[model samples]
Target: MQIKPLIGALGAELLDIDISAPLPPDTLAAVRRALFDYQVIVFRDQKLTLDQHKQFARQFGPLHVHPYILAKPLDGHPEVLRVVKEKDDRRVFGEKWHSDVTFLERPVLGSVLYAIETPSKGGDTLFANMYMAYETLSDGMKAMLEPLTAIHETPVPEVDPATGRPLEPMRLVNKRGEHPVLFTHPETGRKLLYLNTTYVTHFKGMTPEESRPLIDYLCEHATQAAFTCRVRWAPGTVTFWDNRSTQHLPINDYHGERREMHRVTIET
Candidate 1:
């Protein structure tokens, strides 16, 4: 039940508590509170089964079934994504900076990722605080962006010989949506810089070419070291991050080794 802040920016590690067992109402409330207080929370030396993991995450929100088939779900667990990087694979999932599922009408609230097995040297995840990203902007910049809306989009996936084309999450739904460029946190009532490297296409009326300069500048500005924290993974580490307030980048330095993790998305 002890909380240790990992860095000055916005991450913390929970100590002396096992999440596998059923938690009391007050304890669950405290954990949820910590999520808002510190945008990311890491717990080490924990053991949890697939059901146990989902059970704990469901306390926060209903599980999200990912619209894109980026990774296969574990057998019999439709809501859990198996994030595995094989030894021969060149690409690692989530290598760029992004908040989860921004293209959707309602993006997910948070994510809980549990490291099952990790590489010997590197596969850390870096999280940058968007609240800081927005706060640090100049007053003129904030005023200009506060009322603007932006577009978020995901193109159709390429077809493979074996797997086939995958999409239309239980419904052939919208591929693009217009979302407010300036996001206000529902619970905390704080503003955040909502632009992401992956899904954000452009400002509502501008072309991609016209938007690049401002977008590039903001991307470079938001990810500065002062607003970021890195989380190194261990075999039994569990991490929960608030997607509304942070964007994450996964380091793909372990080329020859494998890293396996189980992730659940919380759609509040």
Candidate 2:
């Protein structure tokens, strides 16, 4: 497989490999190395069945079953999660920046997403390199963050603006956990900015009000343009990202357009 960088900081695209078929052991090893090196890798123009997708992801580790998503898993494949937005849907999932499933005590190690349907325009996913975000911080700031742990919780349903009634309840799983503010990569031995706007609510010993300023500052700083890359989606495209070392935001610009994707999360 030929690997090419997608952006200066973090992403790379892999070419000439058909993931629908089994990969050779050496090639799989190379792919794992590239994932750790780049944090996010994309494979374009590939087709995969739901089973094939789950098989490929399981090669990395056992797949994770998302506890809170209301959508049912694909038949016979409990590990696969369907992410779909209909043409008239105005609300979008994953529009905010986050590392997947951070509310779990053992958060997902990584995620593999395969695009089966996409809008004609405006459905790109942005990934930020948290390793770079942490590395670039001032020593004083790094020192302060190293010992801190932050709380992460799954979101509750919002009240509908039209009727002033709560939206249908989403299944609440294990909703909360505390993780280190600076997460160290288990394989790369590098520190990453681990707090996110979506799930992280406060530092361990501080109230939400007291943690607001610093939390806001860190969220803004970690997602700066220089540390990020945007992947424009198309059918037959698959992207894998190390959730431990990066944060992602899916753009919600394509209103009145349909988009569908299948995802598998690997255990860390």
Please, what is the TM-score per model? Answer: 0.93, 0.95
Question: Highest lDDT among the candidates is held by which one?
Answer: 2
Badly placed stretches (over 4 Å) of model 1 are 157-174
Candidate 2 lDDT, 79-127, residue by residue in tens: 8888887787776677688999898888677999999999999989999
Give the per-residue lDDT digits (tens) of candidate 1, residues 98-162. Answer: 88888888878899999999999999999999999999999999999987787888744444212
What CA RMSD would you report for each candidate? 3.2, 2.1
Using TM-score as the measure, the top candidate is 2
lDDT of each: 0.87, 0.89
TM-score (C-alpha) between model 2 and the true structure: 0.95
Q: What is the Cα-based lDDT of residue 101 in candidate 1? A: 83
